[model samples]
Target: MNSKLVILGGGAAGVLIAMKLASQNIDVTLIDSKTFYEYTPALCSVLYEETDAKFHQHFSEISFELEPFLRKINVEFILGNAKLIKDDKVFIHQREEGIEYDYLVICTGSSYADPWKTQNGTECIDLNRRINFLNEQREKYKQAQHILCIGGGPVGVEVATEISYRAPGKKITLVDMNKTVLANAPDGIGNNAQRILNARDSITSIMEQSASQKGQEGNTYIYETDKSHTEIKADLVYNCIGVTPNSEFLQANHADWLNEKKQIIVDPGLRVTSNVFAVGDVNSVNEPKMFYTAHMQAIHFVRNMSRIIKNNTNVENLIPYHPSRPNMIVSMGPQYAIGYVSGIKLTGWPLGLNKGSHLASWGKYTIERITMNSCHLKIPVNEVLYLTSRP
Candidate 1:
């Protein structure tokens, strides 16, 4: 009998790995809490106005149903939470018996404050639930007169600027503990973002400040800044601080496999043990936790896994995974963006050409389609609407 391979998480890493392995006539089972796989990089576009219907789409449009895609690729899809992992066996939340596997890969990924980054922890498990949740948030954003965005990172900055483009008159206060926006990025990029935020209509940038939620009354949210000790109120507050890894399931018996930040620790080959491996945001690889990074890791791991299986090679013979240099594109709005790639700073028309008028929504859609195509799944009509490669 062929070895049984089980993969956890349905995000970029796991999904891509499953597709690649299944193509090689490998038997694989994928378990994930989310029923739909979302193209999370385009999540910011969900908050903004749809100036161009061809480029803009609802959050649901970018999130493809997982079962159909996985099944089409000859991979078994299990819709359940992974509760525990014992030696050679994995357990689910409601199941009493553990599922046996010859090889295991952990790609549980991370969770964000926003619902768009839904994975294992998110309450919206199905497509309908996610659609309703996103619609509710969009309604709140449309009616909000004052908005507070806590954090000056990519997510916070993108949310602030996207809302600004949609509702210019709305008063938006962006607070961050850093000296400027995009604090983790290159200094020049952050400086450029600060200038853009300052010039944007009614979007205020309050740097070197941190805010704590006081409470909420009706639709109003109250917050207090730490450094300034000032109280601010807004109709809506977005907590875009950062993401937490979905590695809590490993805490029961495998706590030693995790780091202080609760991320899984793996070797250079992305292996946790002789038969176990970890990938994507859940792993502490000292690299940027972007979807592209996750995708690259999945491709590399799949290649290594193929060698181990077909050639019956030892673990030491597997190729080591090298960390790639950081590359990121931060979209401020539909027409403008700033990026860092190959140790060079980029902005304006070059970014505009890459991201298009819809703020990289097209590029993200293309990525989703490419993944779906690789898995031998049919693209839905809603997704096909934005299929043009003009971006």
Candidate 2:
């Protein structure tokens, strides 16, 4: 029996699944708050425009209209806030009727920072508008004697490196409560990142101290760290810390499926319920919530879904979900980046080999390969199922 599949996110996972399933002529619907998708990997590069003329040129490439993309793949795109999830149905605000589905895939991602950067990477035009302001702020920051970045996470480190490349001679300070940069990653990752970043003469990093408070007074910005009443002053501040899950809607109804962190918990096959499954950051998978990992889970889920849709009797042959290997590509500047793949560091020649570069040639390639979005995917069931289940 064919089924109406509804996916409740427009992130890497949701979009890839929907596009793949839709290409197979499956009835699919994708719901998101925005009409477009923002390619987040390219977001940091948007600020490092090669020429003044091409300031907004890359914005188009980084973010694009989802409606047309979905249309091309034969999936329906609905723009609205998903406010609730009930028995086999999703409730959307500003819509008179609810959408019901035979199978539901929840991929709603997580986000961090003020003004809340949705992990889904939607609200395209709106984000471009904000980036414009950041461009202006970048100009202002270029003139400031000192700048304070209050996180050593990806965003903070990326922006700091970008500034070091774009606007040298200005001081950039990064503060994080962790012992090192990218603390969640492997020890080598954080240590190597710290070594590269601190190598810059103008950059300063403060670790193991939590930012207690931040406020602006007149022309100066103030940040107080938790220990020793440490006060740091700067002309501007960027808070690039913390992530809040976008799983509140599920809590109101499917509370039992959520963990203590409010993240959706799922079985080995990523199933939340009999006909409900989850992928990406919204789910409590024991792995880093990254675009690559999400897309991997999407492929896994879609392949198994194809099997289930084909024959339910071979349930044991359904491939199990596993956490992707711990890998990271942190762009340091336009020409350099810190990347680790399967515990092996990627560096040297071929400018696009690693994560850094305005071209993002390699990142884009990996994304395209991982997505397989528009491909008509079919699974060969009863296969070896040799994939292991750990990072």
State model 1's lDDT. Answer: 0.77
TM-score for candidate 1, please give it.
0.87
lDDT of each: 0.77, 0.71
Q: Per-residue lDDT tens digits of candidate 2, residues 1-391?
A: 4579999988778887876688563589999876667666655556556554565766554566788878987888888777788878898775868898988999888876633254333233345565666577546655687888888988888878877877787788888888888887653666667776777887888889877557878778888888856788888677787676788776677789899988899888898888889998888888887776777788789888888776663544557787776767777876667666556565433443333443333643444333333243212110111143234
Model 1 C-alpha lDDT per residue in residues 1-391, reported as the tens digit of each score:
7888999989888887887788674679998888888777777866565533422455546678999988988999988788889978888885778888899999999988865576465232887777777777777777889999998998887888877876788999999998889878853677777777888868888889889989898879999998887888999888887789999888899999999999999998999999999999999888888876787678778878999888887987678777765666777776566766556566544434422234333443455566545444423321232222112
Displacement of the residue 309 alpha carbon in candidate 1, Å: 1.6
Error of 1 at 128 (Å): 0.7
- Which runs of model 1 end up more than 4 angstroms from their true locations? 51-57, 119-124, 215-217, 349-391
Clashing pairs in 1: none
How high a TM-score does candidate 2 get?
0.84
Best by lDDT: 1
Residue pairs with backbone overlap in model 2: none
